[model samples]
Target chain A: MAQLTFRESIARGIAQEMRRDESVVFLGEDVGAAGGVFKGTVGLLEEFGGIRVRDTPISEQAILGAAMGAAMTGLRPIAEIMFSDFFAVCWDIVANEIAKSRYMTNGQMSFPLVIRSGNGGGLRFGAQHSQSVENWAMMIPGLKVVVPSNAVDVIGLMAASIRDNDPVVFLEAKSLYSSKMDVPDGDIVDTLGSAKVLRQGSDATLVALGAMVPRALDAAEELATNGINCTVVDVRSLVPLDTATILREVSATGRLFTVEENPRLCGWGAEVTSIVADEVFYDLDGPIVRITTPHIPLPAADALEDLAIPSVERIVTTIHKSMNS
Target chain B: MASTKVAPAQSDVAQKIAMYKSQFALRQFETRAYDLFLENYVKGTSHLSIGQEAIAAGVAAAMRPTDWTFATYRGHAHTLARGVPMTPVFAELMGRTNGLMAGKGGSMHLTSVEHGVMGSYAIIGAHLPIACGAAWSAQYRGTDQVAVAFFGDGSVNIGAFHEALNFAAVWKLPVIFFCENNLWMEYTRTSDVTAVVNPAADRASAYGLESIIIDGNDADEVYEVTSRAIARARAGDGPSMIEAKTYRHGGHSRADPGKYRPAEEIAEWMAKDPIPRYRLRLLESGVSESELLEIEAQVNAEVDDATEAAKAGGVPGEDLLMKDVWADGGAAWRN
Candidate 1:
């Protein structure tokens, strides 16, 4: 096993897939020689050569359109949209073309492509760059949404996204790029629709995705000392949701708390809360609570940004208050 | 700008006859589609390629079977030209069980990969970059196949059009961006909306490509020009932009009466209808009138057979609604 940062794991995971498949090619702005805008793709250009790894212009529509066309033909292309917010510029292509192509074509075309972007806040990049946009992708019917919280999950999920025969929107938490984890050497793959239970508890279930997973875990540890034991469930795949794991954990805990970085309105938490409220209503001992950012733009200031996104302190306080009440 | 492409060979009588048949098939198909729409047999809306058959027929004749073709929402002619059986095309238009896409994609999204009709995109200018991507795949795989995208004059104003042109030029992709300049963008005149006189060809220089314009009503011209462009692409000379000047005899969609056009202008273009002109050319070139009569009879019979077959098809099954949404052939998002 070797210690790899989340950003390093992005490159490692892509390299693992590209090395395995000759048809796999990667492209985006500054993704080739400049090693990606986030420096997550440092060695891909040199290792794979320009043919396999390419740097495109500042054309989001063209980048995604090319990826879709390439995927429809033969190549399994990975196109990076530098920031998750940039999806708005090319939302028509993503929401209309790539998402619906296979179904609209009645399975005549299989889009084995991945569109990865640095998502969510922590760098104080303000509203445009830092806002979590997983909800935008999740609402689309034909897309498979994935967000990995840590280095190991990032590598595993990236591999799964590349291999899957559907169009996948891989959201990399920008906040966790610097975080490190010990990853096993060689190719590591993970299932697309499985949620991982990091901590086992019975009092409450803390469901989180992307950057919120780590915060949920941290809050669980603090809540354990306060006599409020909690279970942390990492929602790795949002589309092919492992509702089995979520329902099982939520049922066991009898109380559900969703830690979301996105805005509160119609967030992923609301859907999960709705599902729990419908399926296992009698199993609940307490009301379900969602801890999320307010329905407002993320601020650029360090203090304001920290307050906007769900932090460990916020998760602990929200869960504790709900449990006590 | 001068046309930089090498002059193409003179089409033989056999090739001319084939082009005539292709155009005849398209004209009949569109005429029948409009009739179906009026009779309420075709639901929603359909954009017909009535007078613009020459561009589609010519491009399809010039293209190899392995080459890919992308068309706009008004793509019935392009789809039919690729030799996708008329019955399935008509069935899709009528939203039948045996439709090309099993009625999943209606008239606007005809896709028959086996026939090299990649797809018919509804969005303006979206398929240009997609065609570039397909060309990129062909190049990457060393397939020597080319991708052709057909759009209207309006798409030139869209962002994707410029981006795709530049991307294809930069990458040296084997793709052709064909613009069927029907002189109007929806209800508006192309000249009133577009800055350049030739929407597509005028912008070719910006992407370091040659500017070439052809008479879209002339099937022979479209076949020769596109053949040259396709050969250049296969030879790895990169992309080409062709603006085929034509006019739509009907409205943009089934709803419009096309009163926006001037009576004189409509009369002028209607006189140059590609079918009759091609027929006259054949007769003047010493071709027997009986030969032309035979082609007309065949096209009429084919259209009749296709319409009958399409009308006989049943509604799609309920299970198909959730199928094909994912690769596993199920739309289950959660367990």
Candidate 2:
């Protein structure tokens, strides 16, 4: 019941699960002696030792393929790919191998595997490092994608992802890792395929994911004084999306403003926009708006990188414009 | 780059005939599958291992019933050698309800975990790391089970191949990297593609793994090498890299005439056809020549029956299309 940072929550969640289940193993580059480059795996090697908490070579293909194999053969391995950008190298492994094995086997195979990676922008690591590519995974069937916006969801979703039968890509928001938030004590597992309404409102719906939720909440806080009550929703697990909650929220408020770190076009926000137009077309009072990074590579320049991603001010302005339109 | 992996051993006549029979069955099975595929008997494509039957037979023979195996798209021989029934294999190829994937995975993606043929990868080099993981699982569980991966020379350059080799070596995983170096990477030869010497055995040193090159067409050679490697793996001596130097008799897939391959090279390999070579070897060892032909006749009959069963194997029920998309009750389908 104490405050834990997002990184701490993930480490604790993984540690807790590893302790509870003997089949659970943590394998990744620098996951052992280095305790993970981001420190999310800090105390695991000491607690679980080298056997359970393994340090693997820097190979995304092996990390994913081996994890898929391990999962197929009874053990539940939690594999950590350092950056979401590196998932590019593992496109075939994930899109084809891990994601399709279960169905290809006629449901005979169970891939109780979790692939965790650091995602999103704002620290200015540039194009190669800063990218939220959940869309790549969400586009694939059988692979569940989860983006935790806060420490609480991180712990809850991380636990649930590990226990899930299908392969899950758990993205830990890089910026949110240092931010501290209070989480419930004991085993806290949440349902996947459901979105949580962080703030309820009636004027317009603000659908945000992972890192954008905090910024969306910030925009909501500022919008409150202007008499624009915005409902900020965290679309936690994007694949098995919480369409019911989204449709209901959009139905209540005819305006929808979706936000995320990835490019707006063909992103999760656009998917949400299409869902709104397709399902509840007549319910719209204004144009569906998506506030996101432009379709370009993220730059190393700090200010330009900030310009590329969505911000609190940007989200608020978009909300106001959507309300006006 | 080379070692004494092919040590001499006393060969029993029964064991020799049994190995030869499996290879004979694979040659017949691939030929039948191809014939049916060309005549529109089965939908989609299939990568045949017609010339490389010995590698599969020997590898399957060396593996324990509980040991796992991940193979490439040209995995018919591997799967059949695992002793998976021809009905399911044919049923899968024909897109039938009782098929391995219940008509979903055609030919490129056939999986029969019950027989320990852990789904063949359509993408080359893709299954290498997965085999390492299975080995990792066995190691984690404290079991002596081993995971074997079979890929062609084309897959050696792929990232998974190198990664799996390194991971298996560092982790001391009980696995085998069985490279079926047919010389060509799909349409191109390995000589044209990469600069590494000894395309098979030379790559093992990079991963610090024990490696050997064997005549892939010889069932006894494949059996001897893989058995020793499998023994080392089961004894926790770590992974081994065995490159079986075989040749692909036909084109890479359906409609490929393989004109790109030189006629003389083809003739040379054709003369060294594994099935006949093994048959002659058995006869020379005083085993009955009629006995070998009888075995081949039985295999031919089995192939004919399998072909009939596969044709009658119907497509899955419509309701089944939605099944296995996710675990039942894991999440709700959009209403």
Best by DockQ: 1
List, residue by residue over A174-248, the lDDT tens digit for candidate 1: 999999989999789999999999999989999999999988998999999999889999999999999999999
C-alpha lDDT (0 to 100) for residue B127 of candidate 2: 91
Q: All candidates' TM-scores?
A: 0.99, 0.97
Interface RMSD for all numbered candidates: 0.6, 1.6
Candidate of highest TM-score: 1
Q: Predict model 2's lDDT versus the native.
A: 0.87
The most accurate candidate by lDDT is 1
Would candidate 1 be rated incorrect, acceptable, medium or high by CAPRI criteria? Answer: high
| Residue B127 alpha-carbon offset, candidate 2, angstroms | 0.8
Encode model 2's per-residue lDDT on A108-181: one tens digit a residue.
78899999999988778989999889888788888889998888888888889988887899998898889998
TM-score of chain B of each: 0.98, 0.96
Error of 1 at B273 (Å): 1.1
